[model samples]
Target: MSRNTFRQASLALSIATGLAALSLGAQAQVQEHSQAQRASAFSKAQGHIESFRGRSLSDADHSFEARDLVVDEDGAEHARFDRRYKGLKVLGGDLIVHSGRQGALQSLRQTLNRQLQIDTSPKLRAAEANRIALQQHGGELLSKQPELMIYARGDLPALAWDVRSFQTKADGTPSEMHIIVDAQNGRVLEAWDDIHTAAANGTGKTLYSGNVLLTTNSVSGGYELRDPSRGNTYTINMANRTSGGSILKDSDNSWGNNATSDSTSAATDAQFGTAVTWDYYKNVHGRMGIANDGKGAYNRVHYSRNYNNAYWSDSCFCMTYGDGDGTSLRPLVSLDVAGHEMTHGVTSRTANLTYSGESGGLNEATSDIFGTMVEFYAANANDSGDYLIGEKIMIGRSFMRSMIKPSADGASADCWYAGVGNLDVHYSSGVANHLFFILAEGTNSPLGASPTCVAGNTRVATGNASLSGIGRTAAAKIWYRALTTKMTSATNYAGARAATLAAAAELTATLGSDYSAQVAAAWSAVGVN
Candidate 1:
């Protein structure tokens, strides 16, 4: 089937599910409560625009709209808002306002550190901006409409046109490229792709995890590989194609023998991986699903013939895995990999960290951190929990990455440098990966020995030669809180330090330990201070 046809079918299925869900009284009440909460949060944020803006600007010049509302465990409300100046969207003017349960304002965090005082009118025409962006893109234009918005991510804010283009890689991976063009000067300010992949080098099968229990939905004829308990999250077979696959169905609920020849084996791995990742977030972090909306995201297995990578797409709200070449790598459906890819969706909903530079590194590290945690959470004897990522899928290598010492990958950085952000995000992610390892397991852990920047003679800073860990549970909680509450789209290494420190301080009472010092020391050990 054609890609467009499959997408249409998926949409129809979703619509039908929505209609069926709405017919139920319980689902109706849940929908109503969600809407009511959104409305209330929006109204509360709208009333505090002036206070959040923190400026003397006229209210008419600026307006606020809530994009998402997250209620913390402590009854604190964090409302993320998109800003508009003079009826034009401000790209980097998004902010999150934290409020007490009593509706009292606590604090505000924004992407734009400075006030918006730039001219609204663009000197260049939209058509010219589009042409410039297309010239730089050199690909098919997916979105022809060049939206005019105030770009404030840099040192100075400027009117810009956001253009998106599309292209496919040799391995059948899709790329949705975004180009931010300065409307005043017709310069391509920035460009990035929407598709976030698992590995830079495409590489991945079997009933690798052995016999495992799966949650399947019973249909009229047979049982489908769908988990009704978890928002009906299901797995589909891609038939070695880039797009359009059928849902896996079985005569009985039992799935997969310990072999790779059976197609259902890969499906079993994918389904099991998704289930464990979902449970990890729900039980450990209080996250219902990827978007924390009590909804599940589907998974696509056998994405393409000999394809060696997996990725998460926000546009489809789904995860796609690839069957490996059966040489260096096997299937890319390992438990840690599943957790890593799904965490990308969580990061998108929370920090929405830009996928470039230092923020990009942090984004990758966040996935690696949580991915490892998810693996440990499972405690599967077939696939034992370890800090090494992709160990189960790798055929020759010991693992894809090591959180204990990221430098074991031969490319990842163990310590942060001044120009570390210039490196590829996957490699630069080592700094945070190492920091998390040190924070969770200390410098001399039984798993592996982690060295500090000072021990490595990378920097002469105030760092502990031997640092004690605060345990994985406490460490993961601190990082999760920082990611969901304090971090922003433009957050860098320094911002991450501040966010984690704040999160550690906030949880000190509950943890019964002052993790703030350990968090700070971890950052300093990684040369982030």
Candidate 2:
């Protein structure tokens, strides 16, 4: 059973209703008063909706609905809202409203600034749009009907159809592709996969993290690999199938002997990884679960024969792991790998960064940053914390990616460039990975030496050639804050720099030091400015 219980309650605020005949200052004060009296952050934002919208509140054609809510340590609240025009979802028309501790408006960031003037009437039929999308996708339709949405990401808005389809990739990985087709011409606007895989390439024969502890639920007959404490997050044996699996059970409470020969060994590692990741987010970030709701996600192990990947699917709201070919990889259940996959779910719930281009690179980098944080938080002696990702899963290679100097992997980029977005998301992610490492550990740390793009002659120097880290805890807090509150779907490398700097500014009081300068320097060091 999957515990994806996160839900967004619609606000009853009327778009056409005008505020009382009072000065803007007085009206804002009244809104602030109402916000302080509210219970949850969403409700608080609901009370201040008019103030949040500013001049846009007068636009009766549009309405805003809360998508996510984040409350910071200093009683600051950030609420993300998705815009709808004439009851139709407006793609890329999402915004976040930041409010200070006393409910005063701080700032607002939005993906789209253009006014909506598109005709709702579609010239092409939904079936025709689906056909066009299917022609491009070549996959089974996940939904029978396509939803009509206002596409606002481009220079002008247009009515479009959002189509979802599923297909197995050539590498045996599953793809849940979302395609946006124009209703006016049936032309494909954008397409991306929702099933975020751990690594594009490929995991091994044993439990890499030795003697890890797991929390399982007790049945009348025996104990099952289910965590009652963490949203009933459980692990199941997929039996080498693409879909459906059985929850692992044990006559005795003990699991796996650390050998891949026994199926439970991989399950044990998967369960342990999940538990540690869940704890890391909760203990460090104060997030309750993957979706910040008290619900648990499930895990599927031993998926497909000789399968070489692991991924997190929002549709299934569970993590799926593959048993490797045994020659190259064994089982893809390393702790950092688990953290990386689960953070994708967190990204989906928060920023929902577009899974392509620079935004996609940030999405991947967010996972890598948190994955490293989870490793350090776990502090497992068996699997020591390091900047290397998927180190335990690789056979011949040392690791999948290295954060200290991303270019060490040969394929990943060490720093950002003008056309860096053209690279694959995994390779483009190197820029941000290097930034996070330098921000947290500095240039010449124990992890490894990191070179600036200026030193590499890739770009001219814009800021400090060297940086002093503000430390990992502070860096993680800033990144997490930026990801949840400041970032939108289309935020690019420069936008990421701005978001992190803003995050650092907000965290100054708690962090007891202003790291905004260091954050900017680190981004500049990676040529993001």
Where model 1 places Cα greater than 4 Å from the true spot, the runs are 1-35, 55-58, 201-206, 455-464
**Candidate 2 global Cα RMSD:** 9.7
| Residue 81's lDDT in candidate 2 | 81
C-alpha lDDT of residue 228 in model 2: 61
* Residue 15's lDDT in candidate 2: 11
- The Cα local distance difference test for each model comes to 0.78, 0.80
Weakest ten-residue segment in model 2 by summed lDDT: 8-17
Q: Which candidate achieves the best lDDT against the true structure?
A: 2
- How far is 121's C-alpha from truth in model 1 (Å)? 2.7
RMSD of each predicted structure: 5.8, 9.7
What is the per-residue lDDT of model 2 for residues 35-119, given as tens digits with 9 covering 90 to 100? 5533466665655666545533315678888877787767788888888988899877878877788887777787786678779
What lDDT score goes with residue 187 in model 2? 90
Question: Model 1: per-residue lDDT, tens digit, 74-161?
Answer: 7668788778888888866778777888888877877686777878788988778778877877777876677888887787888898
